[model samples]
Target: MAETRKFLSVETISLIVAFAILAFAGFVTARTEQQRRESGAWVRHTLVVESALYRLDGAIRRAESEERGYIITRDRAYLRPKDEIATQLEKGLAEVGALVADDSEQAERLSELRPLIEERLEQLQHKIDIMRAGDFEAAAEIVRTGEGKALTDRIDALVAEMIAQEDALHRQRDLQMSEATDTLQTAIGSLIVLIAGVAVLAVLLTERQLHALRKSSESLKLAYNELIAESTKRGSLEAQLRQSQKLEALGHLAGGIAHDFNNMLGVIVSSLNILRRKLRRNEGGLDPLIDSAMDGADRAAALVRRLLAFSRIQPLNPEPLDVNSLVIGMSAILHRTLGAHIHLATVLAPDLWPTRVDANELESAVLNLAVNARDAMPTGGQLTIETQNTELDACYTDENPSVRPGQYVMIVISDTGVGMPPDVAAKAFDPFFTTKPIGKGTGLGLSQAHGFATQSNGHIKIYSEVGRGTCLKLYLPRYLEDSEAVEAPPQPQPQPPEEEFPRGRPGEIVLIVEDDEKARQATAQGVRELGYTVLEAESGKEAIRLLRARGDISLMITDIVMPEMDGARLAREAVFRRHALHVMFITGYSQHAIARDGMLDPDVNLLTKPFSLAQLARKIRDVLDARGDLPKGKP
Candidate 1:
C-alpha cells in the first residue's frame, strides 16, 4: 500500500512538471508573436515614411520643371498645374513630418529640409511673377544665379539623411522580427515535443508566417516598380524639354528669314511692275525707276549678308586695326546718316590698343549702331562714340559668364535719346525682336553686331534705362602682336563713265554653271554683253563635259550649291583636267561649301549673287585679266 501511494505522488509531480513546461512554452510563443507584430508595424511605418519622402521629392521636381517650361515657352499651359503641384508639395511635406515625428534624428532632418523647400518655392514664385511682369531677363538672371539649385541640393541631402535613418531603423526592426520568429519556432518545437495537437498548431502558424512574409515581399516589389516608373517619366520629360528648346530656336530663325525676304521680294516685284507699265506707255523717265530697282536689289543682297553675319557663318577677314582711325574715317558718312539735327561727337582715346577683327564687318556694325542711335532720337540727340583700352576682370566675368577676362579694346557707343526698358534691352540682340514700327526696322542690326563681336572672339553688352540714355559697349580682344595697324584705305571716288563697265578681252570664253535656269541664262547674257563668248550648263556634270571638250575656256563661274556635284567638287575636277583654269564662285549664301571652319580660303574669289550687270562685267574682266596670278590647284 505504501509503494502504491509513492507511485501516485510521483505521477502527480510528473504531470505538474509537464503542465508547467507547457505554460512556459505558451508564454514564450505569445511574447515572441507580439514582438513580431510590433516589428512588422514599425517596418510598415518606415515604408510610409519613405513613400512620403519620395512624394515630396517628386513634387519638388515637377514644380521646378514646370516653372522652367513656363519661362522658356511663356505658355500659360505650364502654369495650369501650378496650384495642384503646390498642394501636393504641401501635403507631402506635412505627411513626411508626421511620419518622422517619433524619431528625433529624422525629425531634425525634416526641420532642416523645410526651410530650403520653402525658399525654393519662393524663388519659383518670384521668377513666375517676374515673367508675368514681362521682365524675362530678370527671371533668367535669377536662374543664372544658381540659388535655386543650391537649395534643391541641400533639400535632397537632408531628405537622404532622413531616409537613411529610417532604413537603419527598418533593418534593426527586421532583425528583431527575425529573432522573434526564431524564438517562436523554438517554443513551438518544444510544445510539439510535449503534445501532438501543439505540433499541428505550430505547423499552421509557420504557414501563416510564410504567407505574411510573401505579402510583405510583394509590397516592397510594388514600391520598387513605382520608383522605376517615376524615373522613366522624369526622363521622358527631360527629352521633351530639349526638343521644345530646339523648336523655339528654329521658329525664331524661320520668322526672321520670312519677314526680311518677303519685304525684299515685294520691293523687287513692285519696281518691276512699275517699270513694265512705264515701258508700255513709252515713257522717257526710266532712269529713276531703274535706279530704284537697282537700289532695291542691292538692299536685298545686303539683307542676306546681314543675316549670314547674325548666324556667324559669314567669313571674316581679320586685320590689325586702329578703331579710332576707322571711326574718324567714318565721320562724314555718319554725319550724312544721322542728319543735321542729331549731334555726333567722338571721344577718341590716344594710344588706344589695337584689335584684330574683320574691318568691313566692324565698319558695318558701327554703321548699324549709329543708325539705331539716329532712329532712337527722331528730333535730336547727342550720339557719342568713344574708344578706350580696358581690362575685363574676373569679377566682371563672373556676372557676365559669357565674357572672358582679358585686355580688350572697348568701343562705347552712347546716345542721349529715348532709352529702352530692361526687358527691351534684354532681347535687343535677338533676331526679329523689335520695338520699332513695322517697316521701319528689320531688327537684324543689333543681332548682326552681336554675331560679329562673338565671331571675332569678342563680347558685347548694353546698358540702358527708361527716361535715361543707352550705352552699348563692344569689347574686342586686343591684338598682342607688335605689328603696325593697317592704314585705312582712302574711299573710292565715283567711277568715270568710261571705266564703269570694263569689257572682257576678245576670244575669252567663260563657262557659267548654275542649277537655276533663269540665273544661268541671265549670267550668260551678262557675260556675252561684256564681249566674252559665254558657254552655259545647267548642272555640274554638264559643266565638266564642257570643260573637258573646250580647251580654250578662260574662266569658269559656278554656283556653290548643286545637287549630286557641288561647286567645290566640280572645281576640283575642273582643275584636275585644266590646271590653269581660272574659277570664280558665286552664291546667294552657301559659305559652308567653299569655307573651312567659317573662313573662306584665301585663294577663293567669291561674289554674292543678285549682282548688277555692271558688277558682273567688272568681275569677269578682272578674272580674265588676272589669269595665272592665283594658284590654279584644287581649292
Candidate 2:
C-alpha cells in the first residue's frame, strides 16, 4: 500500500506565494486610497469654513464702504447700492451659520456676528436717511460722534475673529494632509518590500499551518464530544439545583409556620393545665389562666394574618400616620420591653411628615426590632429609636434595586451590642434562619418586618458589623396632601347611651350559619348564653331558607368561609328577603375572603375566628342592638 502525502507540491506552493503577494499589494493600495480620501475631506471642510467667513467679512466691508460713499458724496447711486449690499450681507451670514452648524461654539459665534452686522448696517442706514432728508448737519454730527465708526469697528473685529479661527483650522488640516501624503508614499515603498518577503515566507508558513490545522481539527472533535457530555451533566445538575432550592424554600415556610404555632400551643397548653389544677383545688378565679390561653390564640391568629400578608393575599389598608406621634406612643412600652439593663432613648424628629402604612403592622414591626435589639444587648447597652423625614433619591434607589425613588419617613433603630457577623446578617431576613440557640428565637421577626415593608411599597435595610453594632432602617412612603395639610381626626366626645342594652327578648333571634357542626354548636351556645334565642344551620343555603321562614330573626351571623356558598352571598340573600336584617361575618379564612382589600365593609360587621366566649358575646350583642341602625337592603 502507498502512504498518502500531506505536504503540497512545489508548483502548488508557488501559486500560494503568488496569491500572498497579490493580497499584500491590494491591502497597501486600499489603505493608501483611504488616507488620500481622509486628507481630502479634512482640506475640503477647512476651505468651506474659511470661505464662509471671508464672504461675511467682505459683505460687512462693502456695506460700510457704500454707507461711507453715500455719506461723503450724498449720491443716490451709493444709497441704491446699500440695499443690494444688505441682501448680500444676509446671504453671507446664512452661509456662515450653515457652515458652523456642527460646532456649537462656532455656531453661537456666527449668531452673534449676524446681529452685530445687522446693527452696524442699521446705524449706517440711519445716517444715510438723515442725509437723504437734507438734514446734512445731523448726518455730519452722527459721523463726528464716532458712533458709526465704533459700530463698524466692532463688526470688523467680530468678522476678523471668526476669520482667524477658520485660518487656524485650515493650517491644522493642511498639516494633517501633508503627513498623510508622506505616510502614503512611505507605505507604498514598505508594502513592496513586505510583499516580496511575505511571498517567500508564505510557503514556509503554509506548511506549518497545514500541520497545525490537522492537529487542531482532531483536538476540536474531541473537545466537542467532551463539551456535549459536560453540557448534559450541567443540565442535570441544574435540574437538581432547582429542585433543591424549591424544597429548601418550602421547608423554610413550613418550619417558620410550625415554630410560631408550636410556641402559641405551648402557652395555651400550660395555661389550660394550670387552670385545671386550680379548679381541682377549688380556686376562686381562673381568669388569668384563661386570659393566657386567649392571648396565645390571639398570637396564633396574628401569625396567620402576617403569613397572609407575606403572601400578598391580605391587601394593606394604609392610613396617614404621624411618625413622631407613633414613636412617642411606643416609647413607654419599648422602655419596659428593653428592661432596666438597657438604656432606651427616643429621638423623635419634630414635625415629621406623615407616612401611609397599616398602623398595627407598623407598631408590630417596630416592636419586633426593639425586642431583637434588647436580646442583642444582654449585659447592658444603649438602644436608640429615631424618626426623621427623608428622601430616597435616584442614586440610592439605583444602588438598592428594590427601593423606589420617593419621599419616605425613616425609622432607624440602632443598638450598641454584640453585633451579628456578615453571614448571619445576610440571612437575617430569610425565614426560619436564626442564629439564636434552639427555642430562643423564632427567626420570623426580621422576615416579617421585611415582608411588611415590601408589602407597603416601602423598603427595609439592615446594617450590622461583628462586634460593632446593628442598625435597622425602615422606610415608609410619605403621604402627600393635595392642598391643605392633613387634619388630625377629632377626638371623640363622651356621651352616655340613650338606654341600657336590655337582655335578649323572647322573640329576638340570632341565626348562626357555620359548616363545621362543632363550631356551629359552640357559636350557638355562646349566643344562647348571651340571652338570645339561637338558630343553627350548617351552610349558607340552609341559613337563607331559615331566614325566609323566620320573621322573628333580628340578626344573621354567618361564617365567611363555607362549602357551596359563602357568608357574604348568604348575607346578601338574607338581607334581600328581610330588609331590616342585621348581619355579622365570622371567618377562619384569610382577611381577603371576608374583607374587601383588607377592610371590612362599613355596612357589614366582621368577627375574626378563634375568639373567646366573651368576644363572641360582645359581637353578638353589638349586632343585635344595632339591628335598627342597619341599612335596609342588600350590601
Candidate 3:
C-alpha cells in the first residue's frame, strides 16, 4: 500500500502541470479573441479608406482625360468635359486629404500632392483659355513643347507615388492580419484540448449529483401529491361555503322586498277599513270616502317607489338636507312599518350640519336600517337612529381607508339585540351578505344603504360585539348651501270627481315614448281610454320605428333608459323631424340622466313611474292642455 501511494505523487505532479498548461493556453486563447476583434475592425476601416482613395483617383483620371479631349477636338462638348475637370480635381484632392488625415506619413504626402495638383490645374485652365481664344497653335505648342507639361508631370508623379505608398501600406496591413489569424487559430486549438479534459471531470461530478437527486425526487413527489389532494379538498369546501352564503343573502333580499310590500298593503287595507266603517255609520259627507281612496292611491305609489329604488331604476339626487328634518318626517312611517313591537326612537342632534346626500335614498336607507335593527331584535328592542357631527383627519383616514379627512354628519342606527360577531359585522356592507333567517331580510337594505352612503360621498362603519348591540355609523359629508324656504303642507286640491278632455281635431297627433313595458302599456291605455290615440313601445327602438312610420304621432312618450336609444335621443330626433310633435321623457333613473340632451324640449313634460290610472289621465291631460302654449313637452 505504501509503494502504491508513493507512485501517486508523480501522477499528482503530472496532473498539476497539465492543469497549469491548460490554464495558460486558455488565457492566451481568450486574449487572442479580443485581439482578433480589434484587428478585424482596423482592417475594415483601412479598406473603407482605400475605396475612398480609389474614388478620388478616378475623378482625377476623368478630369485629365476630358482636358486632353477638349484640346484635340476644340468642340464645346469636349470643353464641357474639360470644364468639369477643375471642379472634379479639386473635389478629389479634398477627398484624398480627408482619407489620409489620420496617418502622419500619408497626411504629409497628401499635403505635398495638393499643391502640385493645384498648379497643374491652374496651368491647364490657362492653356484651355489660350486655345479657346483661337491661339490653338500656341496651346498645342504648350502641350507638345512641354511648357506646362512639367507641372502636369510633377502632379501625375506625385499621385502615382502616393498610390504606391498606399498600396505598400495596405500590403503590410494584410500580412499582419494573416499572421494574427494563424496565431489565434493555434491558441484556440490548444484551448479546445484543455476544455475537453475539464468536460470529462465535470461529467464525473454531474453523475454523482444526478444519482443523489433521483433518490430524493420520489419522496418529494409523494409529499407534493398529498399537499395537492388536501388543497383540492379545502377548495371544494370553500366553494360550498360561498354557495350557502349567496343563497342566504338572496333570502334576506327577498324578505326585504316582501316587508315593504306588506307595509304598503297594510296602509291600503287600514284606510279602506276606516272608510267602510264611516260609510256604515251612514255618514252624509263624501269627504271621508274621498280621502281614504286618495290615501290608498298614495300608499300604492310608495310601494312602487320603494321597489323602483331597490331595482336601481330610481336615480339618487344628492343635495344638502338637514338629517333632523329627514328623520322626523320619516320617523312616523318607520314606526308603522317596523310595527308596534319595535321601539323606534330618534336622537337627532340640535344644530346638526346638513349633509349633501340624496334625501329620498337616505330616507329609504334609514328605513332599511330600522327594519334590519327590528329584525335583529326578534322580540322587542329600541331601534335608535342617532345623528351627530363628525370631523375626520388624516389620522382617522389612515385608520379607515375609505374615510377621507373632512367634516361629516354621522347618522348611526343602533339596536340592543343579538349582535353580530366581528366576522359578520365586517361583511355587513357586502351586497347580499346577511345574518338574518330566511324570509326575514332583503340583504339589499344594508348593502343599499352602504352603497347610498358611498355614492353620496359618505362613509359607513359597523361596530358590534357578540351578544351585544350593534351601532352603524353613516358619515355623510356636509355641504354649504342656503336652506330652502319651505311652506306648510298645502291643503288638498279640490280635484274633479272624474277628468274629461274635449275631442281634438282629426289632424292633431300625439306621440308617446316610454321604456318600461308595463308602464308604457298602462300609460297608453290611460290615454286611449281618455279618447286620444295611443301608441306603446317597450324600448326606444320601437318608438323610433313607430315615429318614422307615421307623421301623425302628436305626442311622444319615451323611456329615458332604452337599449339602443334613450328617451332623450328619441325626443331630439322626433322633434327635429316634426316641429309640431310633442315630447315627454319618462325615466326610472332620472337622477343621473335628467339634465343632459337636446332631446327634451323646455316645454316637454316628465312623469315618474308606478303612476296610477287617474294620475296618468291627469298628466296626459295637463301635458296636452299645456301644449296649446307650447309648454315644455311639445316640439
Q: What is the lDDT of candidate 3?
A: 0.68
Which residue pairs collide, candidate 2?
none
Candidates arranged by lDDT, highest first: 1, 2, 3
Model 1 per-residue lDDT tens digits across residues 262-353: 77777778878889999999987778877777887898888888889998999899998999999999999999999999888787889998
Candidates' TM-scores? 0.39, 0.44, 0.32
Model 3 bad stretches (over 4 Å): 1-313, 324-354, 367-386, 391-407, 415-418, 421-445, 480-635
Q: Ten residues in a row with the worst lDDT in model 1? A: 590-599
The candidate maximizing lDDT is 1
Error of 2 at 420 (Å): 1.6
Q: Judge candidate 1 at residue 455 and give its lDDT.
A: 91
Best candidate according to TM-score: 2
Give the TM-score comparing model 1 with the true structure, all chains together.
0.39
Model 3 RMSD vs true structure: 25.9
RMSD of 2: 31.2
Scored by CA lDDT, what does every candidate get?
0.80, 0.76, 0.68
* Candidate 1, lDDT over the whole model: 0.80
Off by over 4 Å in 2: 1-194, 199-225, 269-283, 482-635
lDDT of 2 by residue, 316-364 (tens): 7889899788888888888888899987776777778888799988998
Candidate order (TM-score): 2, 1, 3
